[model samples]
Target: MNDVTTDHADPRTVRLLVALYPARYRAAHGEDICATFAEATAGRPRSAVLRECRDLATHALRLRLRIGPTDPAGRVLAGAAPVALALAAGCAGYFLLPQLRELVHRIRYPYPGLGLGHAVLDATLQTAYTVPWLLALGIAALGRWRSARIAGGAAALLSVGVLALTGLYPYTAGQMATMALVGALVLLAPAGLVDVTRRGRWEMVGLALAVALPMIAVDRYGAQHLLLPVLALLPIWLSAVAAPALLGRLSGGRPDRLRAAGVGLGALPWLMPLAAVAAFDRPARLHTLLQYAGACVAPLGAAVAVAGAVHLARRVRTTDPADPA
Candidate 1:
């Protein structure tokens, strides 16, 4: 077997890979790990060398987290605020732009048959659609946690009132339950802006309801068309729920708990439509099945990606600073 010495190994490549670790970590153990790699990969195939590099990278991350300055909870908290803000921005854009366009249309093309009061009511509803997200985005961006909390709370109450009046007034058991869950999620989300606690997690049961009760209500009502409004507002509902959980997780809450929240919340927007369809009790078409299947799967995929990103962020933030690069 050829004994490849440190000089014989590719220093540049090894250094490049080592750079993936935290600067302080690399400063402390980079040369030693590289030497170990050179010795281990002597007379090995290219696949073996690649495998060793992967292992090294994994070890580096483990060490970085283990020896880093911030604790797990602290790292999570710090990262969560930004995540919340981003989610708020995305939701605002998704739900707001369409309303803005409609508002413009209303201005340009007034309805001839509509009464003045009705027209004013229509305009008020349109404004309601856009205002909560705008408030959330602004307050969250400004780091005004208290104001954001108030905005979220107000939005939740307003959403319930609107839904009850227009969508499900004289509410059935299922609708009542669904709205309760939405309210809980909205109320608890602000907690994520600072930190997540055991109590906050208990409150997140709303997430489960957010996913399940909508379908149950649709089935009970035998109204397939009801799925449209539910699905349309789902992104906003999810953003409201997820922003806080992400904030809590990034701030220092348990990742497992946060990941579970993410999975449940993420699954709802896409899966609710399918669940509504299933409630229809009709024959399933192949194309429809495929479409719903994709919808159901997309959120799960996104949940996994989000979980991985959170983990990576945790590791990156926890690096030791004493060691020089």
Candidate 2:
């Protein structure tokens, strides 16, 4: 066919969309992709065309991210994914309680100050932000891959609308951002990375409970006992310190690079709560203990990511002189 489409679709836009794929991919099927894009979106509305474009870009970006099991980022993700899911699930579960409690309180009272309107809004927000994480994690852990993706992607989009509608962006930005990242991870993570054995799936659920219960306890009562907080931080600490070395040893090579990168990615979700705790719950002594730990860790995690990128660049250069393979 000619470079231009007779069907009113913009040829230039079609070319740009196809260009987002890898050069190898482009070389193989670029023309067909462009043609199909043109044909499918030819008579669609602007919104539909944009949606198609966004979907194409997203898939292209996912490919560029090197989400396969072999790459360093992919490896780190595979290692960190379970932790991310569990922590996200735990965090989501923890936050859900207060919202439920508040909703109940508002319903029970229905006082002048505590209107039914407030209860409705809080319930909607909770459903939007908190419930989806739990749902996605459950569905993913149950090995329902398509359902997990749908649950996560839809939830993330729905939460955006809810937050925007409620006009509570400023107040809930941090929690919303954290939860949104979780949804994004669920949506974008490779199936190879997340689809684990039945035992592994159960372990993920157990870890989620391990994270959520202590956190819930700490929230319910003051930080009077150190054991609770210690238990909460234990999974992160063990995983961060042990996981990299374990992975490195298992892989049977120079484990330092893997270890370094693992430290950063692995510790991230676990440390997130500590960062918040350190900020608002400074009175808790655990925050101070974690404060010193984070200071040492923060720099290392940054270095690991930088180091991984540099290393990958060198590998790509050696493997494919023309372009990334």
Candidate 3:
């Protein structure tokens, strides 16, 4: 283990040499790296701190992907929003974006007046618009009626309409309905939350029905029309099921009470827009996701980064006042 010491060595060169971590991480580690650099430099400058930090950050990313998650604390420390957004974008871009392009070609190339950019923009907008509508319909079905006679009836009707209009029977609307249904049951905490438990079981049934209707409709309607929506809903359904369980473990309640509470609280922010989408059948897709990313994720990421930055900034803050002539 080598020790570090502070001594002159063309401080600018020393500072310039440590600039290789991601800007945010680099800024945090520069001083410490620089101090180590000073020791290694001895009476002369060393030139590889920048390269070293880059390797370190890259290695860190690899380690994260390999290590099974321990708790939400580990995630919180790593920055959850960026990680989730990156993963979502990766999955969507890989799967959905190309199909969306084909849909764009079908709509725009039909007419000659539009520019290439306009066609792309139009497709993006349409896909984006549909997300909210699906979300809205789901919430309305889940929230408005609780009985099999009422809730299932309403979900069935809406499920059919969404399937017809979107050309997929259940779609994201059904997925949202499923999430709401699960969340509602969790709220009930059946057993102790007996009524809620029963309702949750029903909700699961509703979600399954919502999901099922589209598959049946697709078989009836054919694959080209049905496939895209199936792609979209699969992620949401899986996420809805898995997220709560993962969140519960992260929240640290053996019976999952705290996990349920945290999820309920976290979910409240999206409720209004999500509910509105369900009620109105408006598509808020990419826009809603973007809004969540911007309003929710970005700010949180910034706040964490800023806090870290400020901590560094305080250390770097000048201790001496201006010197008199």
lDDT of each: 0.51, 0.61, 0.39
By lDDT, the best candidate is 2
- Write model 2 residue lDDT over 110-219, tens digit each, in one string: 76986888777677777776688688778878877657767866766776566666554333443455446655665665556554689657766776676667667766
Residue-level lDDT tens digits of model 3 in 1-325: 1223323455666555454344665567767777775665554323344444444443344334332134332233222211121122222233333466577665656456666766666565544434332333343335332232233233334433443455423334544454344333222221121222444334333433444444445544665655345443344432343243234333332334333333333323223334444445556565764453344333233433444555466556766566899
Off by over 4 Å in 2: 1-16, 28-59, 68-70, 98-102, 154-177, 226-325
TM-scores for every predicted model: 0.42, 0.59, 0.28
**Each model's RMSD to truth, in Å?**
23.0, 10.7, 22.2
Score residue 22 of candidate 2 by CA lDDT: 87
C-alpha-based local distance difference test score of model 3: 0.39
**Which regions of candidate 3 are displaced past 4 Å?**
1-35, 39-72, 75-87, 90-98, 101-110, 120-239, 244-325
Query: Ranking under lDDT, best-scoring first?
Result: 2, 1, 3
Model 2, position 204, has a per-residue lDDT of 64
lDDT of 2 at 70: 58
Question: Can you write out model 1's per-residue Cα lDDT over 34-143, one digit (the tens) per residue?
Answer: 88888987767666777788667655654555422134433333333323333333443454554666666765676887755666677677566446745754564455
Inter-residue clash pairs, candidate 1: 73-252, 76-250, 76-251, 77-250, 77-251, 77-252
Q: Per model, state how many residue pairs clash.
A: 6, 0, 22
